[model samples]
Target: MTLKTAQNIAKQFTLVKAAATTLLALALSATVMMQAASGASRVKDIADFEGIRENILVGYGLVVGLNGTGDSLNNSPFTEQSLEAMLERLGVNTRDTDLKTDNVAAVVVTATLPAFARQGTKVDVTISSIGDAESLLGGTLVVTPLMAADGEVYAVAQGSITVAGFAAGGEAASITKGVPTAGRIANGAIVERELGFDLATLTSLRISLRNPDLTTSRRIAKAINDFIGNRVAKSTDPSTVVLNLDGSKRDDMVDLLTDIEQLMVEPDQIARVVIDEQSGIIVIGKDVKVDTVAIAQGNLTVRITETPQVSQPSPFAEQGQTVVVPRTDIQVTEDGDKKLTVLNSGVRLQELVDGLNALGIGPRDMISILQAIKAAGALQAEIELM
Candidate 1:
C-alpha cells in the first residue's frame, strides 16, 4: 500500500473508534437514568387530595369509678356540678343535695372525625383529665356529646377508659408508669351526623404536596397526565397540582384517580441542614454540600478557684479576732491538639460529617461551626434551627 493511502486509512479508523465510544457512553447514561427513575415513589405516599382531611372534635366529659384516684370534689367544683347535672337528667332530683365525692373526674374528650364518615360509624377517642385526677384506670366515661368547631354536635362518646398506665402507693411516695391521667377508648365515639362532603360529585381535584417543591410539583403533574394519556393535570404552584375533570364520567373519575395516585414519580427535595439546639440533634440531607473551606476548632477553658483560709490570733491576744482570708486563683487553657482542616468544594453530606467528627466535634459544637460556615458563605444549604 502507498504511504499516503495508509495514513488516510488510519485516520478513518480513529474517527470510527471515537464515534463508537461516544455511542456506548450515551447508552450507559440512558440505562442509569432509567434505573434511577424506576426507584421513584408513588404519588399517594407524598401528596394528599385537597378537601379530604380529618376534622377535630372535642367535648367535656366525666370519668367515674376510679379507685381513689379521682379528682377531689372540693378542689374541682366543675366535676361535682357535672355529676349533679347528669343525675338530674336521669330523673334524679339533686336540687337540694350536697354532692361530695372523689370517685369522679372531669375530663376533656377529643377525637378525629375522618372524612366520609357515615352515621353510626365508630372511631377512637382520647380522654385527658382536666382536673387533678391521679389516674383514669378502670374508669367508665359517661355519655358525652362531641362537638365540632362550629358548636354543632357531631358524635357521642361513651365507653370504658383503657388507661395504659397506673399509679399506686400510700401517702409516702408513688411510682407511676406511663401517663396515668390520660387514656383512650378504641372505637369509642359513634358518628351521629356526617360532615357532608361527597368526593364523587367534584368536577375537579387538587393534589397538595406534603413538602412544597417546584420540581416535585411538576413531576407529579407530569406523572398524572401521562397516566391518563391527556393534559388533565397542571401544576398551579409549588404546593398544588390541579386536575381538569371535565367530560369524564363519574364512575370513570374513581378509576382515573386511582391510576393517577398509583403513578410513581421522583420528588425533589431542598438541600437543608436541620439542627435542634435543645436536643443537640443534627440532620443533614443527602444533597447538602459545602464549598471549599478551612476550619479551625479549638476549645478555650477558664477556671477560677477560691480558697478560704482562717487567720487566728496567737494565744488570743487582746482585741485580736479570727477572720477568713479569701484567696482566688484563675487559670486559662487552650486545646493544642486541634489542627486546621481544609474541606474541598462540593463536599458531600457524609464527607462533611465525617470531617467534623474527626475533629471530635459534638452536635453543640458542630451547630456553632455550621452557623459560622453559613455566615461565611461556605455552606451551600439552608440551615433550619429547630
Candidate 2:
C-alpha cells in the first residue's frame, strides 16, 4: 500500500486497536519485512569499498585584515614577525623598530584531499588560530604550503577567508557568535599533486566491518566462500575479513569482487540496549532478548523553590530601615506505583515497548529500568551508556 493510504488508516485506527483486530491479522503484513523490527541489513550498507579513502593535508598560514579585533600587539609575537617579513618581501623597508599589529593572526590551515582528486582542484580549508585572535572575519590567508603526513607539500592554500560570524566591542563589553577564532573557506586551496595506487596488482581484497561481530564475520566469510565456490575468504578477526583470490586471473578477480560484495549475508550483532542519559536516547538491537522476568520501575523527584521578600520598618521606627529576606519552600513527590510487568517466553520487539509503556516511564526512566534489569541478570543484552 502507498504511504498516503497507510497514513489515512493509521489516523482512523490506533495501532493498538489495529494490532488486536486488523493489522497483524492481515496476510499481507506477514510478508512485509520492516527494517525497524529486525536489524537485518545489507552488506554494502556496513562495508566500505576496499581501496577508497581520503588523504589529510595541513599547512601553517597567517590571516590578515581586522580593524582591531585581531591578535594583540604585545601578546602575539608571531603576528608581529609575520607582518615585518611580509613587508620586507615586497621591497618595503622594515627596520628594527618594534611592530604593533592588531590586524593579523597566525593560523593552521587543513583540508582532506580526496582520493583521485586532480591537479588545480579547489578544496575547502579550515583555519584555526594557533595564536590569540578575537576574530578572523574578513581575513585573507597568504599562500601557504600544504603538507601530507610524509612531510611533502601536496597543495598550497591562499584565499580570502569567509567568516560566518563576528565579534565586536572592547574587553569590557563584547557580543560574539560562532567560532570567532576559527573559520572555513570554501574552495580555498588548490591541489598540486596526485596520490597513486596500484589497482591491477591487487591480489586480495578486504571486507572491513563497521561494527564487528563474531557471528557476522563468520556469515560474511561463508557468504563469500559460497559465492566463489572455494575457500577464498578468511576472518582475521571480528572486524577484518580477507579475501584471497590467489591463482585467479586479474580479470576474474575483478568479477569475483563484484559478486562477493553483492552477496547478502545476515549480519549478527550482540543483543544490546544503548542509552544516552543526557539526551534520553534508547537503542535496542534486534538480537536483544530478555529472560522471563518481572520488573517494576519508579521515580521520586525533589524540588526546592525560593521566593524573596522585603521587610519595611514599622511606622516611625526607622524611616530608612529595611532588610532583605527570603521565603524558602520544598516539594517532594513519588511517582505512581508501577505494576510488575512479566516478560513472556520468547518475547518480541512489540512486547518490549508495550511492557515498558505500561509502566508509564519516560525515556530517561526507561534507561534506569534497563540498567537494573541488566544488573539482575534479567536482560540478556549488553548495556551501553553515554
Candidate 3:
C-alpha cells in the first residue's frame, strides 16, 4: 500500500476509536443519571427491624470533688440528707450532726441501653444537676444504679464528669458558656443485665419505616420478597412491613435480616410545604405543586412629625401670656413598585419559587402570601405550620 493511504487508514482508525470511547462515556453517564433519579436507598436507612431498639435508663446520683461549686447544703435540704445517708451507708453516722458540705451536688444520671448489649459492655451517661449548682466543671460522679422503665436496675454508672462549659464571675457580672450544670461521661456505665430478647427464635419480623408512607412500605416489602424469591414479605399498613421467616429459605434469621437490609428501594413521600413562622423559614417539597394564582404584596407606611413651639405675647403687654402651640405633619405612602405576579397552573417547586421571587417580597411576606394562597384554594400541597 502507498504510505499516504497507510497514514490515512491509521488516522481513520484513531478517529473511530475516539468516537467509540465518547459513546461509552455517554452511556455510563446516562446510566448514572438514571440511577440517581430513581432515588434508591438501602432498607436499613429507611426502616428499622422490630425488637431492635434502645431503652432509656435513669437514676438519682451525686457528684463530688467540686471546688465549692456544688449545690448549697443549706438551700438544698435534699443534698444535706443525701450526704448524711451516704455517710451512714459507709459506716460513718452523720445523722446526729449538721452536714455542711458545699462539694456535693445531687444529679440525675441518664443513659441509653442498646439492644442486645452484653453484660460487660459500657455505655455513656449524662449527669444533670437537679439543684442550684453553679458548675459541675471539676466534679466526679459517684456510683449510681441506672434503672429502666420496668423499675429494675440495668446498669451502674460512675466516672469523672466531663463538663463542656465553665463559669467565671466577680461581684458584678458573670459569663457562662454552654451548660455548666450538665455534663457527660464517656463509656461510664457497665451493663449488669441483658434484655430478654432472642432474635434467632423469632418466627416473624416487622419492619417499621422511619417516615410512614404506603408506597414506600409496599416498595420495601416488594424488594424483600423479590430478593428472597418468595412471598415472605407483606405490607399491612403505611408504616409497617411484616416478614414471615418460616417461608424464607435461610434458617438463620440474622443472615436473612442482613441480606434484606442491604437491598435498595426507592421511598415515596407526599407533597407538603413546611413553614416556620417564628424563624421565617419556608421549605417547598419537590412534589409540591400550585394551581394558577395571582399574588400581590404591598405595605402602607404612615409617617408623622411633631414639633412644639412657644408663642410669646406681643411685646410684653400687661395682660399678655405665653402659650405652647403644637404643629403636626403626616405623610401616607404605599408600595407602588410591587406588582401582582401570576403563576400558571401545575407549576412545580422551582417555577413556584421563581414566581414568588418575581414579586420581590421577603420571606416574612412570602409566608403570609403562602397562607393566603392556601386559603384561596390555589396551592395543591398541604401547608404545615411550624
Candidate 4:
C-alpha cells in the first residue's frame, strides 16, 4: 500500500479508539451515579439524640386579677379554697369565715425543660384554667413548684401571665381574641434541679434515628464502620443506633455529637402518608415510590353565577314597582383529563412533589390522592392523619 493511504488508515483507527473510550467513560459514570442513588435510604436522613430528651414540668397555681370573669365563687369551690390557702400562708387566719372570690382562677401551669437546661435558668410556662373560669388574662400565678414525672420539683413558676387574649363587657356582649382561658408567662419558671443523667460518665454513646428502619440502620452501621477502622456503631433496633465509646476516643461529648450529626448517613423511613386535616398539609418523602400502578386525578367544579334580572310590572301596570327576580344558576364542571405519573424506579421527594403538582389538584385533593395511593398498595409509607 501507498504510504499516504497507510497514514490515513492509521488516523482513522486513532479516531475510532477515542470514540470507543468516550462511550465507555459515560457508561461508567452513569453506573456510579445509579449505585450511589440505590445506596441512599430514607432512615439515615434524620436523627434523634440518645440520652437527650425534653422533660415536661407541670404545676398548679392560682391566677389573680380578673374582673368578674374569673372562676365563679359559687360554682367553682376550688377557687375559694385556693384563695383561703393563699391567705393562710400569708399569716391571715380567716378559715372559719365563708369567703367568695371573683378575681382568682385555679390554673395548671406547664413548661418543657429542654435538654441541657441549667440550674436557675428561666423558661416560659403555659397557664390554662383548670376551673370554671371565663378568662385568665391579667392573672398573677403565686409560687408554684414545677415537678417532673418522677414527682421531683424541678422549678418554681411565678409571674403574672401574659395572656394574649382578653374578654370585656357584660353577659350579652363580649369581645375576645386568641385564647382568653389560656395564657403564656414568658420566662416565668426558674429551673431548680438539673437533669439526673450525666452524659459524660465514661460509657458508650448512642446514635438514635428519629424514624428507624432496618435497612437504614444497617447502612448507618456500615457507614460508621467504614468511616473508622473500628465498628463503633451498631443497630440495636430500627430506632436505636448504639455507638461504643472509649474514654480515650473522644474528650467532649458535645464535639462528638457535632461530628455524628454532620456524618451524612442517608436515612430510611417507612413509607407514610401524613395529613393535617385542619391545616390541609401533606408531605411525601423521597422514598415514597410506587410500584407499577395507574392513578387518575379529577376536578369537580361547582359554579353558581347570579344573573340579577330586575322586573317591573307590565309596562302599563298601575304600581309599576321594580323588583329583583332571583336568577341563580348552578353548573358543575368535571375534569375529563387524567394524567398519570409512572414511578418505575425509586423517585425522589422533589419528583413526587412535581408529579402531584402536575395533577392540578388542591390541598384536599392531594390528601385524597395520597390516601388512595396508600389504599391501593402503591404508596410505601405509613399514613397518619393529624
| TM per candidate | 0.83, 0.76, 0.87, 0.70
Q: Write the per-residue lDDT of candidate 2 for residues 1-386, one digit (tens) a residue.
A: 99999998888778668676775566546533543355556667777657667889998888888766678858878777877887898897767887776888889999999877889998999999888788888889998889999999889998888888777777689887888888888999999998786544677878889889888888888877776677878888999898887744336555666666766666787788889999999998866777888978776889999998998888888457788899989999886776788887567567888888988889987888888878888787888887
State the TM-score for model 1: 0.83
Name the regions of candidate 1 deviating beyond 4 angstroms: 1-39, 247-251, 304-332
Worst 10 contiguous positions by lDDT, candidate 2: 27-36
**Best-performing candidate as measured by TM-score:** 3
Question: Distance from true position, residue 274, model 1, in Å?
Answer: 0.8
lDDT tens digits, residue span 204-323, model 4? 777777666787777777776665567777888887778776532766666556656655466556666679978998866556776555667877899999999998888787876998
* TM-score of candidate 2 against the unseen true structure: 0.76
Query: Relative to the unseen true structure, what is the Cα RMSD of model 4?
Result: 11.1
lDDT per residue (tens digit) for residues 190-251 in model 1:
99999876676677889999999999999999877666677888999999999878643335
C-alpha-based local distance difference test score of model 2: 0.81
Off by over 4 Å in 4: 1-45, 226-228, 251-255, 276-280, 291-382
In candidate 1, where is summed lDDT lowest over 10 consecutive residues?
247-256
Cα displacement (angstroms), candidate 1, residue 14, comes to 45
Higher lDDT: candidate 2 or 3?
3
Candidate 4 whole-model C-alpha lDDT, 0 to 1 = 0.79
